[model samples]
Target: MTSATHRSAAEIGRTATGPRPLPPLGSQSSATELSHVDTTLSNGLRVVAVRKATVPLVEVRVWIPFAGEDKLHPATAEVLAETLLTGTARRDRVEIDAELALIGGDLGTGVDPERLYVTGSALSSGLPTLLDVLGDVFTGAAYTDAEVGRERERLIERIAVSRTQPRTIAREALQKQRYGDHPATREVPEASDVEVVTPERVRALHAASVLPRGSVLVIVGDIDPQTVPGDLERALGGWASDRSAPRLPALPELTGGNVLLVPRAGAVQSQIRLSAQTVPRTDPRYAAVQLANLAYGGYFSSRLVENIREDKGYTYGAHSGFEFTDQNATVNVDADTANEVTAAALLETRYELGRLGLVPPTGEEVESVRQYAIGSLLTSTSSQSGLAGQVMALASTGLGVEWLQEHPARVAAVTEEEVAQAALDFFAPKRFTGVVVGDADLLAPKLTALGDVTVGEQD
Candidate 1:
């Protein structure tokens, strides 16, 4: 019964019709509260057990302050971290792997200038087995000749490869400029030194610094909180040592200076690494500083990224963020660009830094960054593994579950004026000092033209 006078599809689509308006984004709410029990073992082992029953799994994080005070310690500790779990007195590498696999668990180890870390996860019921094996490896690792030789060679090779990277050169140069002969600057040891480390040296270094008396452990899982502490105490009781009788010396304070140009021969790219000391999480101003950082260069849509990456096309990425150690905190800004525009990029970078502190963020900008900060904090700890890592890392800095549960409110309460004040106090261009790594011959003319650059020792 329909008439045949209907227009074609293209003709019918010519009418002027408006689409429906979308709803505005809702305001941010409070983050999820983390519930956990905190206790200390008799031997000075800080233990925090968080109850997360979303799945039948557990995450364990053990952090040891293995301060590499000398070249020997740094090289030896590097080898030790690689070979620690390869074997134990009772369990060879094969036995250890099989034992962990049997319980649906896995283990990994890493060492930085500040600490040695052992991280793993397992089914909730297998927590006891996981702890037993970790204890065995920590207390009685069998550093056999074959295992030490193999791991040492592999580590040396990796270091050689890493040293060739421009970012690695920039990082090392920046570390030296900041810390200056301090042990904290020796995160990556010389390959020649690592090649000379013997098995006996690794065993001795382990005996000296890897003490349970000065470490912390965190466990998050679907288990009874009342019984988990007892399980941990019994499993790790015998890992006692008086070597770290009091504690390792804390990191020294860092100072900043003019940019140091580190020469890399015959290169076409430059890496800019910037650093400045900042406040710890315990400071009341921390929340405000976090928001200011997000607005400036702490996120993808920040002013620094917009200026350098999007607006000017000087670099592919530009970011600024914070780094926290046991007793020290620092802000770092990083960017890489083509050889010809290195000076221009650096100039724009400094200009943005000044602009952030001087003009500060408006109320709208502050609110956007505040929401991002709160949302990220909540999302990071939503999973068992993520929560365990967060709590454990904070525990090492003397923060607790109370801080984690309450930081969102602090971030939410930060006013625009406070964010502006934090920016002015901490983010001034004068506060930062760093290095520029590139081909010296290619970069020397323009970099020298930029002035305030000194020739630094190159890798």
Candidate 2:
């Protein structure tokens, strides 16, 4: 018994004894080693190249400053951006698909409200071949009438199906209510508009929107800048750097509080969206507002999520985001929850907004969110795909490469008081526009206590 007791005491001492190593104090130091981007092209094509010898893959992205905001030939720019890959002068749809499939590569393009992006990824061994193919597709696309009609059908089908999704309907409705007649608010084209979109319009938009002077080329992974730039220039130099397009128009003024509720027949839940005017992308308060939004409802542990989801069990998720574009800026909050709790959830969201106006985040919380955002940004820069995305964002916004290099410091310098001020400026209830998609008949009585309500229905 004495022997066993001594052995146990020794074991306990061993378990509790000795010094433990401390964790790395504080967060990681700001990333000092960033990619070397040379913006040498004079025709406004911001070229970004990263020569990483480790991976045998390359990601090339061409971001053109042509999106819905440009609106040159109705919807032609967007249609061209979408269907360019369907056929080029040298390659038809089937042939192009077969070639890309054989090499396990993909061709894709998209249009947001502010910019058009064409992106493709392929193995480094196939870089030279892919470049030729990419050049042909970008510069030599033939927007045939057949292709236009086909893509129109596909788009119509997409719209028809998307309208059935509650989230999609809610988002479209919300934008219309928030922005009113602004072209940015037109998320989906009507059947009349879609039918009128012709091949001639698509060709006309291509001529005006895809100007070499306003484009940027970003290439990352196993590549040398010297050789790649020369080759790209040769392949794409034929593109005239003529400045033909006019400057984008001034953004429309914020259309004040108008609620739009699209009445669905029997919706079990309601999707609600609230938006208010915010500072533009170049605004000095951009980073400060970002930190404040994180504290409000931008993250998983944000106040809105903690209160509405964790405590109240009212929503699957509730979050907010800031949309910074060339013409306008806005902060948006979204939640989808049971119909019975819709008004409560909205009121709680308003309460959070009002609270931010009254009291700001603590210095500690502000710093934490700043650190979180910077860390995430750095982590994104670590990958070639993410690096290319960063370049594309800078190009789309007419920001220089140095903008990203200085982002961490900018975020770090934002003070708690500044964040509070940004919140008040952005989250004014009077400026907020509300939109709901659900059974209006069921939700009317429940939401009537909040304010005067107007309901709309789709044909």
Candidate 3:
């Protein structure tokens, strides 16, 4: 073979003039105006159907406000979601599966403290069958004793495994620290409560909480937007109630204070979770806040990750993102670091937070994150499923496809000054409070010495 020379990575990245400048981002194309209908059916379900004719498949999402203050509400709600599609009066579990399979369809149900979610998909031709199956389950799910018993045991096992996870433990501590005993904190149900859940309790909850008056149904794919609402009304006409679905009680605002040091004895690594309250998506300042978040820690190239992960090697990854609960929203930052460096990681994490406000993202940094924000929006809604999910989230907040189409313009209009202001107002170090969970013996001295940190009893 003839000998050949290869350039080093540095050489390959350079031109005669030196390092090459990156090509400018191409002009972004606006999304096609979606053909969609946003109408409330006579049966009280808000139906939003969009015609995307790109594929022969249709995606479905249902959101029902399923909140309760009862002590056993979470456990019962969990069991109800597990068995919701297991059987209906007209079809047993296997029969339900068979009918959907014949139509290239599948369905799943899940619940959290704030809402119940039923997500499904099917071939466009099978839209009628999918709606009929959904209507049947909504109106007449049996929650048979056998099905409830089996699923309860499985849920209990899953909960047991999840509760032991480091992330789960951190999440629980943070939720409690931020919200006190708000029902929204009941994200993972207690195994003891799930064990005591009976079929009767599940059915009772199904009747009381799974109403249609305050629910939303989103359908996107190759379908007629105008006709789908009529079809939904016909199929689900019986699944109605005068009582609206219950919204969760508003959460008390979070106040920043000392970080709680929760002891996870003998752990080799630690989880650092930080949170601060912020405006919801509907707020006028939200677009600016969104960009500020991306530049801070919402994206991989953010200040927090660049400082802690790339420059300092404190953690494998670090992220900050928004969490929207109903009409409320908050920014959350998290990282997992070795026990040896957890204290240092926390310091740098806060340092970056403070720097984001004081130093602020430069004009170049703002432009970079702005492009990422718009590009991600376009990418996420490029598919039928993605569009459906996006619409569902907006509809839950009383918005529709119009908001989806207009969000890019909103983001584009946010000025660099607005972003800097948002960073200063929302990302101040004094505006955050959270938890540092690790071995107290190893972490307490260094962490407590860091100030704004308090050692707590072992968890």
Candidate 4:
């Protein structure tokens, strides 16, 4: 038997008598500019058209900031999203679906506390028809009582079931804990409140916030960039409003404090949801921060997973990530484990958080995650829908495809020191405030042994 020789860590992935190196990576770069057009209409609808001649279809994204001050707007807005396409003045639900089908197109609507999103796709030849249909809805959606009633019933039913989900329960507690009674705290309104939302209320909310002003439209795939503005003008020029779309009451700065524990009876698992305020993508430190997040738990191979799932067997999966917005961004960590192991899992999680700050990431680790970050950016923008999706998401933050194209350069340029600093600043356990939702009887004693305890019941 041969004896092995000692080697430095850098000497790893290689050996004196080792397997030959695999094929070399290609030297080509992916920082090329995306060919596209960007313009905002006189009515305040921003249009971005990317010409991709590869496929016969076009992906469209339209975003309207329909924020309002009403305590019941979320419930009413949800109903509006569900019923908006049910019927319009010119076309009933059947006619709308049939028209879209004829053009091999479809559209869907959804709302968060912040904005209303309309996403659709159509055969390239049917761009005009798709736009016309969208324009029709924008100008003439009729929230008929029957359609609104049915949608409201369906929405309330979903909300009823969703409230029972562990993740939902934890998220609600975290949002409330973080923001108090701010409108942002109430993303998914109460089912009872939703049941009370009438067609007239929805119509009023629509009239106040569903205008073309303060909206963006994105089209990608086999479209002529030069003429998209003209076509958009022809279709959407008539859809105009002079009033500004209402804005969300500004989100309060998240103040990090103690862990919020929400009780659930007879549950066998626990959810840990953590939030730490962080910088936005536009910040110069963002690249390093992004890499730091990936190394910690933004991906499967991150430190959080390495400690909890791989080493401890406490949970099947764990993750840490960021949710970016126009004005702010936040770091979030999530884990779910058996009720019995909940306290231990959270202890290990906090241990990892502190350890990452103390030790920082090694140069090798930073390089590996940096490569992953850059690779992910390239992959996400490689296809037509992928590019369209990235652009649409960025548009919400007032960013363009140029930001996506330029991101690879930033990721590649991030140094180990930068990632380490970002880690120390953002990954420290004290920087976070969070909630642990689980069977209180099973969790309270163990978690109380770990720190100050707050036993409570909340939904």
Candidate 5:
């Protein structure tokens, strides 16, 4: 065998010079305008279809507002989504699966506080079969007693496992800390409540909540946009009702307040979740705010991550991003740290938040974040599924594919001064409030000493 020679890691990383300079980033190209049609069918469902013939596949997304005020609505809705396609009057569970498999398709449903979502994909040649199967489920799902009972037991087990997870606990604590008693806070249903849900109740809830008037349907693939409305009318014409889907009640605006320290005894790790109110995507200044958010903690190379994770080694990761509910939006920051360094992590986290507004990002930093934002948007919409998801999200907010096509220009036009102003307006530390969950006995004294922190009882 011939002897092999290789350079050391450090030597390989550098050129003949002491260090190498990275090549300048290339100018980003604008996204092509997608051919699309947005229209309302006779049944009152808004359908948005886009033609992106990248592959021989079709992606579908349906969003229906499914909010309710009943104490058991969450559990009922959860069970309803799980058993939605288990059977229909024309087809049983096995037959439905067989039909979908023949078309290289799969479908699934999920319900949150805001909406019920049905998402699926199929071969382009099988588009009609896919839509027919969907229409059958939407209009005539049986929610049979046997299927309901089986899924209910499975869902209860899943909930039990998820409730014990640290992230889930932290999320629940954060929602309660911010929203108090709003319906939007009820993301996960109670296991006890799910145990009580019967087939009859699920059927009744489906009948009352699964209307299409205020809902949106998005389809993207190798299909003609002009003819999609006719196909949808033929498929979903029976899914009609005079009453529109019920919208969730408006959430109370979040304001700065004391951070709550929630005790989790014997836990070796802690979660820090911070929140502050901010503008939605429709706001004229949103482009600047988006860049500012990326520089602060929205990306891996953000200030918060550099301070807490890279420099101080207090957490593995840290992030900040916007959470939109209907027309309102808020920025949230999260990090997980060991119990010993939880207080230190919180201090550094707050320090970065304050610094983002006071010091602000320079021109170099603004350009870096702007490039990242535009690049992410382009990459996310380059696929059929991604395009469908983006369109669905925009349609839910009363926007369309045109908004996505024009977004890169908006980000490119944002100025460094505008980014600084957005940082000052939105990223100030005093504008935030949140929760830290850990072994309160160990974390209490240090966190309370940091100011604006109070120990609270966990439910």
Candidate 6:
């Protein structure tokens, strides 16, 4: 082998080779402006448009900040979100789907406590029809009694199916234990909750929460800013504005020193999730934490992957992430291993945390993470749809376009010290609430020596 191969093998995995040269700008690269125009119609609808002359497609996204924030029960918001797509005044469910199909376009909507987004994408040539269809579905929906009943049944079926999936059950249990009685803690609404999701309730929610004035409209593709804004205004002219922001209570911080475990009897493998509150999107530590996460277990080549999969073949892959939100943050590390190795895998993961924090990775390891992150960011923002997604997030959070553009520099600016500090902040296995979906009788004794393991059935 060459001297280069020898050096690579000897190098500690914590150092970067050298600073990366910036990529070229202009049409040769994704250096174009995130040009957009913002206006409100006479009826209080807010309209924003971004022009991307390269792709032959357009994306329209409508956001509602209601599902995850309200003081209502945890599952109610998600049930309401699922109910909206059932049918409407102008078209039944089949007809609505057929219309979107004809243009090769797609219609979709999602809800979290903090926001709801109804989005669609289509060829640029089909923008007018797509926008018209969305306007009809969102603003002019009938919310009939028959449709509401049908949707309620469907949501019930979904909840029933989720119980059989080990991974799904584990996640739901984790959210409940982690968030406690907080509104965001709950998973999907059951059939009984859906029974109360009346047409009147959905309609009331539409009026009170789905404010077009607070909404963001994104048009990306071969569209002109000057022309696109007018079309959006015409389409959403009837949408009402709301000056008042949705009232969301502060999320309670996680309390101390307990490990939560959900055990599934007779299961061959254990699915584990350990999490804690971390940093928010607007926090300056966001970028630093992001890079640090990439090195820990966020990436395919992260420390957990090397230890769990390479060094000891415990599972396919182990990873961690920092999910940033408007108000709260979550840093979770997830992995799945057989009952016998579950305890060992968890111990190894803890060791990695200590090594990354207490023994700070070399400069090379840090640079590798930086390069991988920035490179991924560059590729993801190459399309018109991608650019529009970035813009929508910025507009919603009131972050500037420059923030997106400067992401690479910020990531590159992260020092080894910051990464070590982030590691120290996030990785405390002793504080983790562990969920193990496996043959609990066999796994409990093995895991108890590691920490205080609370075992409960998956039901």
Off by over 4 Å in 2: 1-26, 38-44, 51-54, 67-78, 98-104, 244-248, 253-258, 452-459
Worst 10 residues of 2 by lDDT: 66-75
Cα lDDT tens digits, model 6, 1-459, are: 655534553354434765444444323133446676666566555566777777688877776556444444334555557666667778887887888877778878777656778878888888888988877876777767887777667777887888788888778777777776665555555556666766777777776776665566667677777787678778766666645336345666654345556767788888878776777766888878888888888888888899899889999878898654556677888888988898898778778877777776667778888877777777766777777777677667656456777787788789988888877776655545646667778888877777767777555
TM, every model: 0.93, 0.85, 0.98, 0.93, 0.98, 0.84
Ranking, TM-score, top scorer first? 3, 5, 4, 1, 2, 6
lDDT of 5 at 240: 98
What TM-score should be assigned to candidate 2?
A: 0.85
Taking the tens digit of each residue's C-alpha lDDT, what string does model 4 give over 1-459?
999999776667666888547565454367657679999888888899998777899999888887767778889999999998988889999999999999999999999888898999999999999999999998889999999989888898899999888888888988887788877777788998899999899888888888877788899998889899999898988799898666676677775778878888888899998899998888999999999999899888899999999998999999998986557789999999998899999899888888887989898789778778888787877778888888988887888888888898888888888998999998888888888988887898998788844677644
Ranking 2 against 4 by lDDT, winner? 4
* Displacement of the residue 44 alpha carbon in candidate 1, Å: 1.4
Q: Model 4: residues >4 Å from true position, as ranges?
A: 1-28, 457-459
Shift of residue 331 alpha carbon in model 5, Å: 0.7
Cα lDDT tens digits, model 1, 1-459, are: 887887886766565664434456577667666567888887778888888999999999999888855668778988999999999889999999998898899999999888899999999888899999988987899999999999999999999999888888889888888877777788888899998999999998888888887688888989777787788778878888655622346556656568888888888899998898889999999999999999989999899999999999999999999998886889899999999889899888888888988899988889889889999888898899989888987998888888988999999899999999999988888888999998887777787787767776555
The C-alpha lDDT values of all candidates are: 0.86, 0.74, 0.93, 0.86, 0.94, 0.72
Clashes of 1: 0
**Roughly what TM-score does model 6 have, to 2 decimal places?**
0.84
Error of 3 at 375 (Å): 0.3
lDDT, candidate 6, at 208: 72
Each prediction's RMSD to truth: 4.2, 5.6, 1.1, 4.5, 1.3, 5.8
Supply the TM-score for candidate 5. 0.98
lDDT of 5 by residue, 160-264 (tens): 999999999999999999999899999999999999999999999989989999999999999999999999999998999999998899878888899999999
lDDT of 3 by residue, 105-188 (tens): 999999999999999999999999999999999999999999999999999999999998999999999998898899999999
State the weakest 10-residue window (summed lDDT) of model 4. 19-28
